[model samples]
Target: MESGKKGGSMESEKKMLESNSILETIPRDLVLEILVPLASSSLSDICNTKRSCKTLNELGNNSYVLRYVSLEGVEVVQWEPSPELLSFLPRCEESGNPEALYRRGMVEYFCNNKHEDALKFLERATNLGHEEAAYVLGIILLCNKDESKEWGIELLNKVEKRKRSRNIGLSELRNKCKAIVRKIWLNNVVCPEEPLCSTLACKNNKRKRGQGWDLSDEDEQVMFDCKACKWDHERTLFHNMLCGSA
Candidate 1:
């Protein structure tokens, strides 16, 4: 009777070992697919599991899994791409993944301030029909005050048209872009020289010309161009009224 009981115990242990081995042998991609839909909290628990659950923890590090969690608004540690994700970036870019390109552009723009690199990646993503990427690129271009402003406006208009055609609600990002464009159009005042003034009064002052007015307080009199009292009166008015001085 004792020998038969020991034999049964050995058989159960062997089956358990086989089951664990099978779980370890499952493909990584399949594991990731299964884990992607799990809640971030649950995923965090899995990552914190015992050393014996190393396979489960490793699946938590998969790029697709991490990206899905990010999209779900989960605050994963090192929420940005890890070395593993960076390693797969080239492959994803070659595969024409718009999200990958967008992510790369955002990292360059926000982290490194590499506008050119960000523009290159974001442009590629936008060309591939990534609306969010287009919105971001458009805003960046609009703020640049260079040749890119036209292209930025063009992209923003395209996005607006697409949204209208699809009957989609307007996004806050689109609204912000529209507001910026409107502000630029409404305030189309020009500065005469490189050293621009901060206030609208200074910018619109007709008496000011070529950079700024030269003010002097010699003999308790303010002077603009040393042309007698006319210059002094104008300078004093500018200093006392516009500049808020006594």
Candidate 2:
């Protein structure tokens, strides 16, 4: 019985070694494509892969893997990124990882008050097709001059198209935006000072008011047809989305 058990264990070990060898023989870029998604979704798999062998360990530790590694695990490192991440974030940002860019942009915008630089990072993330980045960028643009309103609405409308398609947690995103903005001085900037959209006297409150994020077609149509109300509805929605969630 003991001999049989030992023989089984050795077979397993040999199979594992052969698999590792096969993995090493594959092209580096191909391996990276497989590993990046794994790292992004499963924290455990990549950690074990890194521990299994030298070639993989080196690959897992390098820029390609680091670029898209799960941001969820490192979310705590975002606002108060550790000493190492201060240096590491630039590499991830330079590699064009949307999540990394979004995180670093938040730190720069909210924590460091580096508005121009932060906007650049957020813009890069949005251009890379990061929807959450687009949502936040839309709100930020809305907070700026009136000239920014058109582009702001354009970006937001793009995201709103996808808002209901997947289980992307648009509501949760709204709450998060409200929470982050409320923590800083930008809280009031999001809400227009006019009467609440909840009230009939709201600047652009036409036939009826639109709900926070759930405006019906007719309600939205009314809000948009009247420019004051459109801006009102949008600003109010943003304001309420931020303040409402906060």
RMSD of each: 15.9, 6.6
Q: Give the TM-score of candidate 2.
A: 0.67
Which stretches of candidate 2 lie above 4 Å from their native place?
A: 1-22, 76-84, 164-172, 179-203, 206-231, 240-246
lDDT of each: 0.52, 0.67
Residue range 85-174, candidate 1, lDDT tens digits:
555456556555566677666556645567789789989989889787787776566555467656766786687568768776334443
Over the full model, what C-alpha lDDT does candidate 1 score relative to the true structure? 0.52
CA-RMSD of model 2: 6.6
Q: What is the lDDT of residue 163 in candidate 1?
A: 72
In terms of lDDT, model 2 sits at 0.67
Relative to the true structure, candidate 1 reaches a TM of 0.41
